[model samples]
Target: MKVNVDLRLKDIPGQLVAALEPISKYDGNIRGVVHHHDDRVGGRITVNVIFEVRSEQSLDKILSTWKEGEVDIAKIDAFFETYPIQYLLVGSITSKELESITKGLEAMENVASIEIRYTGTANSSSRAALVTGKASKKETLTTLESFFKQRADKHNYMLIRGLD
Candidate 1:
């Protein structure tokens, strides 16, 4: 079974991973994780973790682990299937930079996965990419904007259909 969890934890180092450790401890493999920031008002951190579980009843252990860790479980959801969206990431290409780009995307809400390759362009040239995600077009676009802005590269976003 695939389940989603919304957890609130202290915005501290290793706290996110600490809260997530129970997923593996409970025999669940994390399929995705998104940590969004809402700093304008309260300094609360929201972490959305998606995992595959062996038994639906195993959620108890997961919930208990969260409480022990002092993490707040805002919500949990089980779904039969996921909604997918695709987007284009076209910008400067570099094997070294892709890691940062990929990590940035993963730390966002609704971004399930990222696939990166390169286009044969010069150093200051651009490349084409395919990013698959489990979010709405709007959500994905917002994630893209945040991820793409970290670097001083020219990245363009073109929403292919079915992302809505």
Candidate 2:
């Protein structure tokens, strides 16, 4: 999993190295690190580290090590796994129908996020939209594709699965 950790460390020499060493020691691959030296408060500075670990267990070890070393952890964010799907829709679909499509897809189980970008003028009757969705499971995306196909058939819209 990819993780972003925000840490507060004392404004003293060797603090950054001490805070980062455990991540490597526990087999975490460091992607980026930003040390905010100027933004100091209460003699401490904030450092942001983005890293990836093989499993949650390895991340837990690094976090515990930091806790033992007295590293003040402010925040941690982990990116969740997602299976993505995209569709190109072209037809005389109305705004109300588009909204209904978005809402129905969002209500599905394991659907993480949905993004829709429309092309052509809104005033024109013929419009195109790129609908992108990410789900926690691949099967969920497959279900979404089936659902979209049904909607497209009923509405007489052209639904292309992949642009290429």
Estimate, for each residue in 1-164, the C-alpha lDDT of model 1 and write its tens digit. 67998887778799888988888989988999987776212456888899987666677788888887788878889764445645555556565556666777677775655565556553545566555656523446655654555453443333233334
- Name the lDDT value of residue 99 in candidate 1: 67
- CA lDDT for candidate 2: 0.86
Which ten-residue region of model 1 has the weakest summed lDDT?
154-163
State the C-alpha lDDT per candidate: 0.67, 0.86
Number of colliding residue pairs in each model = 0, 0
**Worst lDDT 10-window in candidate 2:** 117-126
Off by over 4 Å in 2: 85-164
Residue 31, candidate 2: C-alpha displacement in angstroms: 0.8
